[model samples]
Target: MTSPHVAALRSVALNVPDPDLAAEFYTEVWNLAVADRQDGAVYLRGTGPAHHLLALHPGEQTEIRNVTFRARSADALPVLAERTVGAGGRVLRPVAPVTEPGGGVALIIADQDGRIFRFVHGDAEHDVDTAAVPDRPVRLAHVVLNSHDVSRSQAFFERALGFTLSDRTRMMAFLRCGSDHHCVAFGDSDRDSLNHIAFLMPDLESVMRGGGRMKDAGYPVGWGPGRHGPGNNAFNYFVGPFGVVIEYTAEVLQVDDSYPTGGPEDWTWPPGRIDQWGIGQPPTPAIKEAQQAIRFMPAAAF
Candidate 1:
């Protein structure tokens, strides 16, 4: 059998204790517009075409509900279902039509690793009005997963989904389905958790401007305003509502099939200052503790 062909990182759903606060943080701070909202959930959209890039659902604590991905086509859904079964992924729900913000069909499935995956097809697109929205993000860049065994998670994603290895460092691995260096990555951890969710900024100036905006609103950079070694992306990070680490990144290295896949520790790019300008640092001890103090969000919140 072949791997499931995924195109883009659709949206990430989080079951946060305070959906209202979480919703406000993304809307007011990140500049994501409130696409829609009901009693227990709120959908947020960037200046891009997809319905909502983030979903905040009511829960007891802050935890990821699911990560949604876009498949190549309507027919691709059946192929994904079949391949998922063969790989021990149970289909939480079979394929069905959906007419939500992004009109399309979607289904819930989970791999053996316990990560819930939702796949969508035929979703309506959005045309960002840049002149009207100055704070809009370019797109959802990538999400880093903290896994029990990074290798196991990496292999499952590569072989089960059509994700290719974009790069690897001593402690992390970047996987990509498209040219933008990586749409998903994995980091070493004792339990499954989220490392961070990144949003693509238009340019370096936007990153600084956005960071300043966050600072003005009382959220400071937990880490970043740095340059990474693998993807060569300039990054600035902050802790959002529910203690979730969010990042604004620009100039993410792009790669195609010909991009050399290196051996262990054979990263393509040379080591540079964590901050290209030779300044900035990683998350502080307090921020690290807050991230490590994640509370569980149950699988079934409906």
Candidate 2:
């Protein structure tokens, strides 16, 4: 069977201890606006056209609900459901109308490792918010997932979701559904968890300015103000409240099928450097621990 075509990474849903408090930090400090609220959940939107970039729900602790993606067409949903099952993944929910904020037909599935994913088609979108806000995020850049077996996770994305390998670093395998290098990546790890979520800043200046804003808000940069070797993106990472890791990034390299996929050897930096630029400090213990703390909510939670 052919893999379904995924258009782009859309949004992410999380169950946090305090939805109200999380909403406040995301809107006031992280620059996302409140899009809508329903069923005691607050939906947050970036400046770009996707309906909502994040959905914060009340829970006992912070855990990822699912990573969402927009399918290239509505027909891809059923195909994805079928391919997911064939690829050793389980279909938690068949294609059906989404009653949530976005209002689209969605398919929910879990990989063999139990990481949940949702694919939506014909979702609602907002008019571009072009208010000239300097440090506001335009949209989601990517989501990095930790995998005990990176190759197995990568195969699921390729055989089930039609994502292409953009590049492979020693610690991560970057995969893409569209042109922005990688919409989803898998980090080599001993557990299945969320590594981080990246928000697309308007420019390099915006990324730096965002790092300063986070520091002013009492959340210091956990890693980087540097360019990455794989995506060629400028990033500033922070460990947010409740140990949720997030990043402000810009200038992701665009590519097509013709682009060469580099291996780990091609992405190496100098001894003290973790990214393309050698200026930033290595990832902190806080961020490293936070990366492996947020795991996917159980499938029964759906």
Candidate 3:
């Protein structure tokens, strides 16, 4: 009966100052091809099969130190690491499997904002010939965070990553881990690192052909071809390549368990609820004038 959320996001490690220009801007805006590189780390994957989803290294300073996921085997990862230390969350770091020709069983974890999530168990023998680049990349749905206390980081990923809550406001919150409405999301306003990382496109012309290939690779589009209102998906936000805050969503909003949970959609702030999925479009006034020329120095102001 081992199953306390079997990990599911295998790789997302970035420390890039310039790991080959963040692997050539994630292989020219999300084609994600390179799957290996040594010591100075660089491994990306997405054309299919998942041996990696993105990892680059070249740190000097610049945060978002970690975020990984994947847990469907190895006997349910120590019962999901004892439900992430019984929900108070603290497993700092651990490592073991390094095997490669497939068969999966990798691990890495950290939460409560040291933020890193990696876990693999099986499947990823390597694929994606793409016939000649017809198009591929169908999973790894969402990963967003910018929490000082977005309701205790959305109640710690809905209590250690089973993640089911679907909508909210007071800054923002939209969670879902296994069914594709959203894999992760959190925003308590006051920003910094880890704010975007989503992938799930099959419609809206593949989110306007991946936002017109990240606007013809000039790269700079933080926030939406627009449509939100909580996981109604159809979103877009960019400024990736090492610092990451990228997304390219599609139709989101799915629920079960009768669809209700928590009060005020669970924390007030619901107005038109960020457009409630009517192709809202907002956020790119040059991404709010580059987040109003950043000055938010909190975390005890360093």
Candidate 4:
């Protein structure tokens, strides 16, 4: 069995038409700081370090098509880079990091679906952007993907990219690439693009306040302020800058060797179940067995 690589999501590159507006939205609504701008790309991130977490690469595509992760070290980069190409995955770009003030390195690669992922080597601690009242963005969380082939997606992530299974729901599989329950998720669907990118907040209170703050900023709640039955995470999703779906969540499901591996990664939100806290509300509609569109389900407070 190929061992799963321990990698951390570093940054996600989004192709946008308006860099300025996208940059402002991320910094303001998401509470990530504008790290810097290159020719046409703008990078924004929370305070831990690395300078940025999301970079807006102005383009015609409105959704997020590329994702990146930071490897354990520079040494790991070359090995994975070689394995990726050997596995028939195209190396859209060579293994190299863009120069930044923080002094980190990154390499970009494309997944089976042609989604670009920039891999990096560095550990910069994220600091809260205090300019505006910092919403509790505890850490960069997971990203969900709608893929044409779940097996291919799973193979690429597990075989070459290095990720482990954290949980599942019929066709949706959550993977833990490092410490979190799932840094990335794959769902069998007709469309190919990022489903959502999540950030961990401190608590439900912060999540509601952040949602209100974002709404006040004009970005209405795209979804949530609900908990997920699958991951047990308190969640909120909103339309973020660069045509991306952004999430603010806390206490998602987590695992390690102790977590049982194998079996269909299936978990489900029982029909009409709303709020993980078990408050009275309407039930969420059932998702297509595998559709390309994004679906929103708020967890009932159990």
Candidate 5:
């Protein structure tokens, strides 16, 4: 039987020490607009149709609240919930109406390692901005999570979330639920943390322009401006405020069920090269530290 799946990665919620400051950086420097403000939280949107690509909430420390995805259909929710439990994950909240910025029926689940994921169906969408904006991101491309056990995490995503493995590199495993090469990826790490969040720029020009803009804003590119082998995407990464690693990427590979899944052997780079195009510098010490610093908030705390 074909497993139920999510249609796309919708948004990510983050707990930041100062939501307003984070909101300012995202709006002024990153090009995302404020979509909504509720209590002390802020919802930000990209040029895409998704209601909001990011939500920032006030917290004592910065941490990932949850990564959200859009379910293919309402029927998929209960089935996914069942599969989640079967895969050793817990249903943090049963399928119910979401009261947050994007109103939808959501099923919140926590993987065995305590990483939270929310699957929503019937969420509101904004009118898509079709005009080409040079440095603006259209939507979330993918989220990379650090996993202590790559195999176990991969199994849960496959069995419970119906995500297919797109590729497995030496340090990471990319998984997809839809056409985009990967909606989520797992970076092998000693602890479970958020590796980074990637935003989809309109094109290669936008990726470079955005990187320049970030540099102008005093945030240097921590790594990239290079094409990745597995996804074939051009990227520029930065360590944003509160040690949150963010990326601007474009030209992500799109694939169907017929696409072949490659192993680590297929993704090796030459000596002194980190990506397909070796023009970019390696990730800085700060970037490396930040990538593993933002842990997910305990499921019970949210």
Candidate 6:
């Protein structure tokens, strides 16, 4: 069988208390456009045609349901499922046609901390945005997860999906499936949950405009308006419902096969390692707490 490999981040699914309210926050404040809806679940897309980048489903609590990754080919899904199961990860759901709005075959697996991951192929791409002044994201950038055992989690990503480690910090790992700095990352945490989800803008101007739109909609910026040390992307963080963090980021660094990777010791720490502009206070207690918080209990089946 061919080795399974991921191509890019496809989408994120969240289980929150009120899907309608959360959907509004995403569509109105965050600027994502709805692609489809069924059975109280909403699929939202960005500027490009990659179907959707976020999915909201009904639930009493709020927490990540799954982080979805796009495979290079439909044939890759079975390979991913086989290798993941062979490597001791649990197949929360077998490979099958996704019943959700976006048509595709998806495999759901539980990572080291039992966080769900959905690897999908052959999803329908939606119509492109034609807004007069679209501020919707150019694409879904990356997802950061709080891991109970980061090393273990990182290993699974590398082994099962052929993800390359771009950089490793004492408390964070940057991994990539394609050229982008990272499509998935893990932050050291006592428990499992989402750290944040980032989406790309064409340039710094779009990032600022998007943030301004969010702020005008009553979602104040929680952090950023600065560049980061690793990917060197400009960022603006806003807290969404159920304390889910969303970032409007632009101009992320890219790498090819020849680019060298680094570990914590090799990184340039301090002097705005997290924030190159040296702006904004350090992460607040709420931010720290949210990193490890479990906002929703995963359903027994996918």
Worst 10 residues of 5 by lDDT: 1-10
TM-score of 2: 0.98
Q: Which portions of model 3 miss their true places by more than 4 Å?
A: 1-46, 51-83, 86-102, 106-118, 121-125, 132-136, 143-168, 174-183, 186-199, 202-204, 208-226, 229-273, 276-302
Error of 2 at 288 (Å): 0.8
What are the runs in model 4 whose C-alpha is more than 4 Å off?
Answer: 1-4, 63-65, 100-103, 123-136, 262-266, 278-302
Q: What are the per-model C-alpha RMSD values against the true structure?
A: 2.7, 1.6, 17.6, 6.7, 1.3, 2.4
Off by over 4 Å in 6: 1-4, 130-134, 271-273, 299-301
By lDDT, the better pick of 1 and 2 is: 2
- Residue-wise C-alpha lDDT for candidate 2, range 56-115, written one tens digit per residue: 999998899999999989988989999999999999999999999889899999999888
Order the numbered candidates by TM-score, best leading. Answer: 5, 2, 6, 1, 4, 3
Tens digits of lDDT, candidate 3, 165-270 = 6667667676665555557767666544466667766566777777778878887566657776555667777766534566777776665556654434544335
Sort all candidates by lDDT, best to worst. Answer: 5, 2, 6, 1, 4, 3
Count of backbone clashes, every candidate in sequence: 1, 0, 20, 32, 0, 1
List the candidate 5 regions with Cα displacement exceeding 4 Å.
1-3
- lDDT at residue 43 of model 5 (Cα atoms): 99
- Model 3, residue 44: distance off in Å is 19
- Number of the candidate with higher lDDT, 2 or 5: 5
Candidate 6 backbone clash number: 1
lDDT of 6 by residue, 129-248 (tens): 766255668788898888878898889988888888888988889988888888788888777778899999878998999988887888777776888767778888877788888888
Candidate models: Cα lDDT each: 0.79, 0.91, 0.61, 0.66, 0.93, 0.80
Which is the winner by lDDT between candidate 4 and candidate 6?
6
Runs in model 1 deviating more than 4 A are 1-4, 132-135, 267-276, 295-302
Name the lDDT value of residue 140 in candidate 5: 99
